[model samples]
Target: MKKTLMRPVGLPESASHPVATPLMPSVVYASDTPDALDAQYEGRVAGYTYAREGHPNADVLARRIDALEGAEGGIVTGSGMAAVTAALMGLLRAGDHVLGGDQLYGRSLRLMRDDLPRLGIATSLADPTDVDAVAAALRPETRMVLIEVVSNPTLRIADLDGIAALCAERGILLAVDNTFTTPAAIRPMERGADIVIQSVTKLLAGHSDVTLGWVAARSPEDRKRMYDFAVTTGMTASPFDCWLAERGLMTFGLRFAQAQATAERLAARLADMPGVRRVLYPTREDHPDRARAQAVLRGQGGNMLSFEIEGGRAAANAFAAGAAGVAFAPTLGDVGTTLSHPASSSHRGLTSEARAAIGVTEGFFRVSVGLEDADALAATFEAGLAAARGA
Candidate 1:
């Protein structure tokens, strides 16, 4: 049997008179040799071994995400929930305490609310808009404070640096999900975030075709523990998805820029239209976090913009159904503009009271700005609103 990797070129080579393996110069892609392993990585030898622990594709995606987020290193997971959950599981213990943002993705809210408690991990919710609320929720046992860079559905920006400073001073870790902002608009680590997580499912992949997630950190040491735990847990992402993620990142800067430009235009138009009761976008003048959004955001506020229709759920649904040029869909960050009702889609996992607490109402509609022609998308919404008003 050939060894996966043999050190010193002949360490105990009991391959006495065995078939000579062709000598190849040291190169990374040693996978051609069936026995080769990723030994060079762990100071063993130079070869490729397991795909789950390390694959060329996974490494490529990790490098791209790190480059995009400007992190020291990164780890990719099967889904967004896995990325966040892995970070927590790797960093926290049974007695650890967590402070969650008030405007959280509902599925994440459930994880904090139910799953963590059963593990003896305690969690408390805080208003991300209020620095005081975040600071007050911290406990001596607090291990990490997690928030979304831009709150979903509502599009509210969090005061990241302020909260990051508090975490740094208190010796706690701060993790931000940059899925909505997509690094091109806001690199949380640049503002003192300890970790930046991404759901490559949305914009990074640029298409709704792939589902993947990642956890990025500023230092290899910060990533070491998580990577170590990930291998044994058996929750690894597939190579195909990793390849799609890497390919998706190459065009991210361009896609993000284009989507954002159209989003700002849409937000401005929606804010002034009749039968539109509210436009919840970070850069809007009336947004509570407008000042912070301007301060930390690197580009036009990201591609998502949510608005409340005048009539209610029926009007919102009617408007969505009437949209022609733009696809009426539940997902975001695609090449074509897509629309959905957050109250029934993304935030549906939350109860009525919980949903209301986060400003998700029956009349709310969220559009993920895509690379579509802005005028065409605008006309589609215009026609929908006209139909809605008449109804």
Candidate 2:
């Protein structure tokens, strides 16, 4: 009876395999003997002893992302920021310098400007849309250039081919954050980026339920270094989250296509709306980076767009209140349509001058379009614009 209670009856292996990836949530794995465990830890065999070191779910997700990005190797991390940190810390050393885009996400800007410096890594910001500006910012100590494929909120497109060529000429590594433009839109590796980072929490996960990220490297050595760093610092993702992300990935293509179509229709309608001061979307004729967007995203404006209201913060507030059909959330890449105020949320840490420099003004509202009917979404925006005019 004690033996039966201690070790429950084990089920025999099934003749057929599960259609879905099996979720293995065990933190500790067991082996038949200490010698076998030692062999597993020493990398003599293929197995997992600890979740932090490595896990099946993470491996599966990493491999899947690697294939998607055309990467030689990859690793999954606890969060998007963790993937960013791991990539930077793993490749760079003390006295190394990293040049990033000036229009990066606020938290990423803070991480480069504040955190990396504490570790003896110097950092600088440049306009990624212009390869000449990036070249001008490079220093003798510069080891890497990091840029988002598409800038957050503003929707400015990066010239990946130009920047990658510049980096290759200077012998500098180029790391691209592809969170906004998933592989569905563009693959940075194909354009000569050495490393591709994705916030799997966003479009890749699709449903907003998983907080995960991945780093895909062009070379096995780079991936090994990042994987070691992630393992050493306990930056690995939860098995359940990886599993959930994998599930979300299955429908990413359909979700992204629908959302992008809705965004295109809404961008056009908003541009003609009364209270709209400006509309920022890649496919729009008046977009600042229309040429670059054409070269990079291949005419896909993606599911995100931003517009400015005439009345600043007050109007933005009224618009949010009136847009009852879509929830006002601070984050992006959800299945349901949502609105975000960058001034109060993602870019709140930056000063007014800094925010204005990146075009994230008080009147700006970034929209994450979803699977809702296009006409219905346009009507919601009409209501929001009317509310903004009243303000």
All candidates: TM-score: 0.87, 0.96
lDDT of 1 by residue, 44-147 (tens): 66444556666666777888788878886699888888888878887788999999987777778889989999999999999887788899889999999999
Task: Give lDDT: candidate 2, residue 211.
Answer: 94
**Model 1 RMSD to the real structure?**
6.9
For candidate 2, write residues 125-210 as lDDT tens digits.
99988888999999999999999989988988888899999999999999999989889899998999999999999988988899
lDDT of 2: 0.90
- Which ranges in model 1 have alpha carbons more than 4 Å from their true place? 1-41
Error of 2 at 323 (Å): 0.5
lDDT of 2 at 15: 97
The TM-score of predicted model 2 comes to 0.96
